[model samples]
Target chain A: MLIGFVWLSLTKAGVPLDFSFLKDFSKRLGDGFWLTVALSLASLACSLLIGVACAAGQSAKILPLRYLCNIYVGLIRGTPLIMQIYLFFYIVGTAWGIENRFAAGVIILSVFEGAYITEIIRGSLLSIEAAQIEAAKAVGFTGRQTVRYVVLPQMVARTLPALTGQFASIIKDSSLLSIIAVTELTQTIREISATNFRLFECYFTLGVLYLCLTLPISFVSKWLERRYDYGN
Target chain B: MEIEFRSLSKQFEDHKDVLLPMDFAGDVHALAVIGPSGGGKSTLLRILGGLIAPTAGQVWIGGEKVCYEGAAVEAHRKKIGYVFQLGGLFKHMSAIDNIVTPLIRVHGFSKEQARARADELLGRFGLLTEANKKPAALSGGQQQRVAIARAISAKPKLLLLDEPTSALDPEYTTEVLGIIRELKEERLDFVIVTHEMGFARHACEKVLFLAEGQLLEYGDSDTIFQQPATYKLRSFLGKLLEWNI
Candidate 1:
């Protein structure tokens, strides 16, 4: 809504939102864009896996595994994502001699996002009625078979909206990795702005690009929610 | 097929017993488990279905002593099908897919065979037109019929029906009861838990009465209804009869 006013005000100030910088900016941010995309997807995949596992652990029949999952999620959610990222990168990353900063960045983002994802997955799974499980078991499904055939599919439908939010968070949070000199989108924007003195244009362009990346996520999530709603 | 419960009982964590120790042996194929609220009718069916384990004692299905959480129970489970009061058809799957899952996943049928079986059941239950609809799209009668189709697709020897008509209107209840009649004609053995004694009298040959998780009476339809032995059965019948009139 403020876009028209922003364009008008910037032009009036003699620092017009220029398209000439876009060519260079795109070229420079191209690798950074791909890197950001890669990191977001990588983190999402890792977080989903971790979330599913932790959900299983939280609902596990065994007492200890449930408690362990509880502690993991509680600790991750209790602290700030940025603090956790810095802690992971500085402490565990250095201790293990993780020379690859990209790997470290991906790891931290996934670990941070996983806490929220786990809650989503676990809540969805728990929402399933005991009658469903009884029906599955009555049909002679092994515990594993029931989870694979019945529980997981329903869980996907229930968690789609939350999963989409988590994915968007992963993408946005990847911007923070720029603090560690990860050369992701934000870092690229900073480098370009420093050289061209086009801070407003670069930052605005970055916001638009992020919006471009995130809008589809919202659309897809809505589509999935509607598709999977079978009126139960 | 025969079912024998030997000293089977269930106790919750609060040290309160849901099912006191009980023993029952029956040679009949179809047993109607009837009881008042909190009488453990559902629990008894669930225990027999292996959804819950008895705190103590053993359950013998077709002469095999079922060991809870062991291979024996798993083996027993494969031949038993359970239907819940609310259909329990997965909302994500259509009516056909709901039936197909048991045949393909549990009974190890090929995809084509599973589809064929699903179609057959859908037609038999008069749900052929609703095959593509999910549980939400179908009527109550259609949903419960589809659930029954899914349960029986695997050809389980024992089918457990838990409060089968509790949620249905009169027309849907008739439609569901009609399917049960068809199953009986096919000689499929089942234990049905129901409140509608008229339907139970028509569908089941024998009855098992449970109260406070104890077996109050086990008898033929005539004995349970006409010559009820226990005071619980007599009072329950009196209340049901009064309500019916």
Candidate 2:
């Protein structure tokens, strides 16, 4: 009903609802979509790596590693992602002479998302029954082997949905990369809207572009979650 | 392998006693540890299994002193298999794989050899039909069977069972009892912490009674069951017999 009313209102206002703009914009949006996907997928891997590392360090039996991990998660999660982007692009990028903005964006997103992913994976790890750990230890598995063979498979099962959701938000969050002039989908949409003076059409096309990118990921995540839901 | 605990005691953070100083030095085929809740049965079992370190003293499993040293404890755990009341089966792995992977991974058995051993154990425990099922898919009794199979996959010299039948219904208890009895017949030494009075009476050669972390009565099962020497042991037995447990 809301969509119909909006359509009528726009039509009455004589707004040119021509989707013909997409005919020309499709290729750029397609490239942008892939870039978004690449950013998300690469960061997803890096984020999970960082997450598992942080969790292991935080829960490590050693004292210094535990303290260092606590500080990493605490500091990264404490600050805003936008500020982190600035810190990376302005300070670290200049100091390190890193000319690649894409690498900067991906790294920033990973470090930002890694903190939250650390908490997710850590909580899931703890949620496993203590009896399972005891059983693993009793069966002659070392601390590392138990974490790898016994705990990790189950942790992946528990955190899949949350991890996918975090990745999806990474897609949404990628829009912020426009601030860095990286020519991603949002940046391209803004450029098209400026050139064609078709604000509504361009913005609506961007929304569709994101939905298309994220919807398939949602479906795959749910399927994987069900496949791994053994304890249910 | 004979298991012994000499001056072994466990205390918590507040210096509160969990398991009081206890001593046992002997070899036996199978011994049953019976006690009430918070009586440190599970604590002692865990300490012996090398899963938890006691606050003081030492443990000798098969006559090797068990300290908290990493390599020594690793070797110690390999010799002693353990099972909890809920079976403690890995939920992610199929019942057969739960028993199979450990044999190959920890004990360096070939995959074929591990599968054969797993199949033999599963068949002996009457879990052939449920072998491919995950622990979550199996009934409580079948899960326990898988646990027993997994525990014995490495051919540990001694097995530690913490209330293996405590979580089962009477029917499932019968299934587990059949396997435990079969283990006895095969001459596998084991220590079981159990609440099932009948199984302890019929299956175990020795009975150990612990109350509030103290060993009160322990002897040949037949003698302890027929004649209790201490008031604590006698009262504990009288209450359980009265409840027909």
Candidate 3:
């Protein structure tokens, strides 16, 4: 295949197909690896909270609250995530004088991913039948009770697969933080390749690391999709 | 319990009224609303169920004005159960979950109690084997049975069924109707909207004929079918009887 030919040619051209760079880079990557995982986990948690909150706000009866949520979601979704990150970092560091790049990355990723997750949650909520809500109301459930007990359980069950897939996407997207010198996996690999001129080995190791993180999530997502598919 | 609809009217913007102004009441075990499609039969049943507000006049439940025009209509709706045309079981839940949801969520029953109640009702409806299955996996008749079991799980005083058998095949229709007939024997009050005159005749104590948002005739099943009061009812019966003839 053409791919095999290219790969072999690249290996022969001193591209360092061996993955020995990963061990060397792992030492240099050091604190950054833990930092990157912490940043991703923190941002993902914030994203879920903000996403669920904004979804509930959007579905509120008050026009002003719903409109505000809509505008927030639109503004976040319309702009590129890279630009949003740069803007947040610049504004927070200069105007607010917040020196922490890690915090800035977490905040930016949360707001960005929150908008996408909000849409997913809202779609799942709306997919529930109107009759079910009516039946709940008929049985004397208050608006809050209906949503908390009746609607939310079904929404969570329906959207779990999509949420897991989104989490995987968020993990991949966390690599973008390297643009701000956050020294994540991608940045560490790039630094290693720049020093030893082992581009293929470094990138290959990075891809494997990403696979290690995302493949498990992908499998879990598929399993959840099968489990939640009440249609079966 | 007695319920009355007094001069109730409802209309959508730029559309003719779906329910014309009319006064009707029921103080019986079972009543059937029978008519051609889009004749406001469902609209009337909805008003009685307190799902939507009427554009004019009021509805009284147990001699209290529970619903009025342009007002928040809050009533003891738990006493009334409405079955939509196609079972309308929650697609996300298994049959037992669907049956137990209203009890646990609305009535604040403990999960153990709700599950016990669901099992009892599913057993009564002969759906214990299918209780773990979702509505989408069940046959039409089984889904409808689950829907009915869900509706009655709250032990409603009044049950309203909107074309419960409309989506089923003849065999399934008979199966579902047989379930309803059995419920009637247990003294459950029902307001059924049906096209099956045969079931109406055999099962309902009274039948009301509706046409173009107006009540055309009301009488016991035999009299309404054999000696229709109006030309509208006569033509309606003629059309329906022709199907059987």
Candidate 4:
């Protein structure tokens, strides 16, 4: 009801709502949508690997390794993703010969998202009560066994929902990669609007398409939280 | 099990001394450590379990000095079981798996052996039907019972309980206390930190009254409850039992 009212009012106010351009651009938009999904999935996998490693490093006994993880998280979180993307792609990426825009975008998104994932994992691990670890020790579990049985299970239960929700953030954040001309959903919309001058229609369709990707992920996140709602 | 604390003290980096210097020794099947909050009862129990190293002195259990360094500490921990106030069962695992996994993984029991042992403990504790439930599905009392069962499943020589029933309602407290009392019949040695005055007096053979990081009174259960040597003990017991039914 609200969306109909808003769309009708905007159309009556001379905001052209011509979605006819979609017929011509439908195939490109579809490809862009799939590209975003693929990018998010690949980054999700990479970020999880990076996040787990960094989280473990943050808790390592070696001071330098712990410091390195702290510094990585601190730097990523302290700066904006846009700035990081620009600097990493233009400066670090070029210097390191990471030339493929798609690969560069994946690397940037993974690094950016990995820091947050690391915090999600570390926070979950920390939330596992000291009593739990102590109980494992009391039962003669080696440090590895304790982590494997007690720490990891509880951590996964605690972090999985948050981590799943983060995929939505990844999909949305991947839109920013359009600035570097990655030809993702947002970039495709930006290109279509530039040619057709249907900025409102194009952006609205973009929002709807992004929601199409994210809403189900949001549902899955909620479902995971309910499924893993163990002894809180 | 026998316990000895020789100038055993624990001071955090902030210099708050949780346990003051103390020297005491007792050999008993059931020893209860009772104290007011922040009185170092839990810390003393942790030291005995080899969970933490005391700052200054030494602990001896079963005639062997408890080592807190390297492989020796792990060895010391292997022979001891501990139950926490929160039950501390792995929340994600079913009750039976909580007991079985540790037996198989840490104690090197074969899967069959671990399953059989877990089943035996679950049956003995009357938790056979709830064996498939996770800790979240169990009651406070049942969770603590599972924790106790898991603690003893590997047949540790000593079990240290840190106020196992403190978080429970009266009914659950009774349920958990009953299980602890039954441990005595099995001849499994245990040191429990408790606020249950009656259990300390009746179920345990020895009592150590601690207050403000000091062992204010130590004696056989009957003697300590009946003839507290210090005013501290007398008043502590009086305040704790003032409104008892």
Candidate 5:
């Protein structure tokens, strides 16, 4: 009833409940939407790589490497993600003189998501019993080989659900890239609302689009989770 | 075929010496270490498995000094198979996959070959029906079988089991012990740390009684059980005999 009342009030106030702006916004948000997807996909890939590497480093036997990884995780996790994005954007564009907002956006998202992924991966790695490592070692596996083959396969399998959820989070968080004017879906909706004075419609359409993208991811993640649940 | 430990001692910073200085040499195919809890039997097994270093000693596997200070112990571990007290099957893998993991990963067998070998091993262990089942779905005995199958898949010369059947019910324990006994007939060398004196007496060629991390007695099973040489061994046997009876 509350949602209906709100919808009626907005429609009666000439807020334009129709999704006609989607077509117009699609034209303006075209290249930017593709760029956003590209940036998100690229960033997700890089973050996964960084996260796995960091997790491995954290789990490493060497003291310095583990300490460094711990510090990295702590710093990233302690601060707000918005601050991290702003810091990375400013550092990359001004200090590093990287003119491409696309590059800056990708780098920012990758590092931001990488920190969270590292924790998830580390948790997954440590979830494995120490006995498994011993068994692998006993079977002629060097430490490196044991981790690469025995530990990693199990880790990836165990953490796939959490990792995919993290990936979806990265995609949603890509909206923050609009601060630097990367013109992703959120930015496109904002531009459309500003031009057509249809804030409600624009946001609703954007929400639908996000739902479309993320709902499948949620379902796929759930399915993958079931499939990969080897313990069951 | 031979293992020699010279003045082996393991001391943790927090605890007293877990393994007291001990010298032992053996050429037997199957040796069982039996002792009460906190006897450092697992520590001794780990040292033999090359998972840890001894504080002051050397472990020679087949006459090669494998556990010297600052040595790459992993090389020595290549010749041994160590099963933990639990089955320690990889939770994320099916029984077949768990059996073949080390084979494909460490031995570099092709995927097809590894699968076939894993099937053969699991089939031999009566786990073919549960090949696709994960460790969580399998019974404790089944998981232990998978672990043993995985351990022996690499065909190591020496097998080290730390209380392999301690976690199982009597029936499952018997099943696992029967499998180990069968493996022994294949000429696989074994060092089993067990609480089951009956299995030890029947399956092991020799038994080493450990007390407070010290070797109290080392002899053939008949001699160790029937005529313990030391006071500690006598008391340990007395306790076990009372429990069993």
Candidate 6:
């Protein structure tokens, strides 16, 4: 009710809440929407791999490995995603021969988000009690068995909610890939607005489309939080 | 079980001695270490359990010198069962899985074999109905019982229980102590660090009284409680029993 009232007032106040471009540009919008979903999923999988390795590396006995993980997390978290996207795409991508925009976008997004996932995993790992580890040890659990039976189960419950929430950030962050002409949802909307001069309608529709993807993700994250709570 | 501490000591990074240089020997089925807090009871237990390496000393259990070296320490730990005060059941798993998982993963039991063992143990402990419940869903007594079951599932030569009933209420404490008493009846050798002086006196054969990181007294449970030699033990016992109902 409140959202409808706000939309009605905005339309009356000359905001031009026109969505007529939906008729002709719907197919392109749908394609862009699906692309964003694919990019987010592909990035999620890659980032998860990077996240787990780096999280383990953060506690590695080798000093250089620990320092390298620390530096990666610090550098990524300390800088802006836009700066990273530009530098990686232009300089590193060219040198590495990563010219495909979609592939480049996935790599960039994965690298950008992997730092956050690393922290999430590390935090969950640390949250496991020392006594639990000791108990496992006392019972003859090999270090690997302790990790497999004791640490990982608790980690999944602790990290599932944060990981799903990170997926939402990935979807929103993938929009910045439009700057490099990856032709995702935001880029598609920008092109439609540039041709038809329907900036408000195009951006508004883009938000609703992104919402259509991320809103369900948010609900799923909340549901997972409850589902995996296990009374811990 | 025969245990001998050859100058066993533990000092943390802050240079604080958690367990001062100590020498003691005992051969008993159930040995209880009772003392005030910060008296190094748990530290001594951990060192025996191979959960922590001692600063400068050796522990010999059952004619084998406890080794602190890499593979030797793992081998030492594999033959001992240790239970904590809080009953550290893996919270994510059900009570049955909590037992079965360690049996299958750590002890290399087949899935069917592990489940059968878990079921029999849970039933023996009167927890068969609650086997499927998670630790958080079970009572404090049940959780500790499951921890004990998991601890003994591999048939260790010795058990180290570090105040296993301390975290429980009076009713639940009795429920757990009952199980520990049963372990005594079965002649399973174990060491317990407990504040329950009554259980220590009654169920335990030998008692070691520790205070301020030192072994103040160590002797038979009957003689120690009835006739404490050290002033610290008397005063400790005095204060403990002073508020008893």
What TM-score fits each model? Answer: 0.89, 0.91, 0.90, 0.90, 0.87, 0.93
- Report the number of clashing residue pairs per model: 0, 0, 0, 0, 0, 0
Clashing pairs in 4: none
What docking class should model 5 receive?
medium
Model 4: CA > 4 A from native: A14-23, A53-75, A91-98, A196-201
What's the TM for model 3?
A: 0.90
lDDT of model number 2: 0.86
Backbone collision tally, model 1:
0
Clashing pairs in 3: none
Model 1 chain A — which ten-residue stretch has the worst lDDT?
Answer: A16-25
lDDT of 6 by residue, A20-90 (tens): 66889888988999999999999999999999999999999999999999999999999999999999999
Give interface RMSD, every candidate, in order. Answer: 1.5, 1.2, 2.9, 1.3, 2.3, 1.4
DockQ for the candidate 3 complex? Answer: 0.42
Candidate 6 ranges beyond 4 A from true positions: A14-20, A62-65, A90-98
- In TM-score terms, which candidate is top? 6
| DockQ of each candidate relative to the true complex | 0.62, 0.68, 0.42, 0.69, 0.49, 0.73
Model 2 pairs whose backbones collide:
none
Per-residue lDDT for B1-245 in model 3, tens only?
57677888889687789988988787757788998889999888877777776788888766767753322443356667778788477777789988787788766789999999999988988999999888889999999998898888888878999999999999999999999999999999998999999988889989999999998888798999889889988898898878575
Tens digits of per-residue lDDT for model 6 on B1-245?
88898888999999999998999888968999999999999999989988889999888999899998777888888788888888478888899998898788777899999999999899999999999998999988889999999888888899889999988999999999999999989999999999999999999999999999999898899999999999999999999999999
Candidate 5 residue lDDT tens string, B119-207: 88888998899998888899899889988988888788788999989999999999999999999999999999999998888889999
**Real contacts recovered, all predictions:** 0.85, 0.77, 0.54, 0.81, 0.79, 0.83
TM-score of 5: 0.87
User: Each model: TM-score of chain B?
Assistant: 0.96, 0.96, 0.94, 0.97, 0.95, 0.97
The TM-score of chain B in candidate 1 is: 0.96
Report chain A TM-scores, every model. 0.91, 0.88, 0.88, 0.94, 0.87, 0.95
